[model samples]
Target: MERTGTTRRRALIGAGAAVTAALSGCSSDEPGARRDAPPSVSAETLLRRRSAALSSALLGRYDAVLAAHPGLAPRLAPLRAQVALHVEALSPTGDRPRPASSPSSSSSSAGAAASPSPSSSASPSAAVPADAGAAVRELASAERSTAAAHTAALTGAPPEYARLLASVAAAGAVHVYLLTKGSR
Candidate 1:
């Protein structure tokens, strides 16, 4: 049967519409339909987050040390500042709580509050050392361990994160050296 131009045009249009709908349905089922969406967090990002947490813990250690041995403040203050900087750099938002501004009040309060009692159980590391030398040595050891962790994490990090981790590791190394060899 012969078809009129109008009829042929209508049929062609309808067929095109059906094909377009089928293709659209197929594309909607694909995982890449939202290609513009932000990607989910990667393992590397999680690792960096853990690294940041480690940095935070190190800062906490510094605070504990200072609280325990205010006499070491003259020597350890600079190292503590460096560790704070590292925590800031490693954290994605740089929003970590800082040590209280009033060092004497904060340190004394932290010292008293954190002091171990016979009934209170806490991690040995959380306890402030009895002497300034011991505090320095403890911080030096912690710094070394943190730096080693950063170094190990670097192997699996992306290039940008690796650079950041390396810089943090270097800063930790410097703190370790100053803690061990610099006059306290």
Candidate 2:
């Protein structure tokens, strides 16, 4: 039997209401569920933390390079200072503490012992290259890698953090240039 227009309209309205009711019930009716949900950290906060960690690691590397080649202090000092600046910029509130000892202190001492003293003969067991050129190349490579990381991190960072990362990346690029120039 064919349905009347009024009957069809009524059925359609009833179906729509039923669907709406089903969807409405799908949400949690318990008030506790909303209240008990854990707070989430924002992506920007996480990115900032990661950038801060990267800056710290770079600072450690600078320390290692400096310790291994004390003679290069005059040149490397500025780069180390710049890395420290980056670390501070990345962590304006200083969330992470600086380590008491340099990351490569142990290796630096071992390398120092193996290399010739100012008044002694050179040895073969040096952990790092004895030449300043080699050290400069190593530092330049590290700076390039850091610059690339900062560039990649810019994608997810908040506006202020993005600008900071961009400035750091630019400084790192300049560092690489200066290091390369000095090595030649």
**Which has the greatest lDDT?**
1
TM-scores, all models, native as reference: 0.62, 0.67
Cα deviation of 169, candidate 1, in Å: 0.7
Off by over 4 Å in 1: 1-39, 94-125
Cα lDDT tens digits, model 1, 1-184, are 8765678779899999999999888885676687677888777768867887787677778777776767777677666666666655666543344444565665334332322221222246488678878767887898999999999999898899899999999989988888888664
Over 1-184, each residue of candidate 2 has an lDDT whose tens digit, in order, gives: 9765678779899999999899877777755458567888777778877786676666666666676788887787777767766765676353644442455555333322222122121122323566867867877887899899999999988898899999999999999998898444
Model 2 global lDDT (CA atoms, 0 to 1)? 0.69
TM-score of 1: 0.62
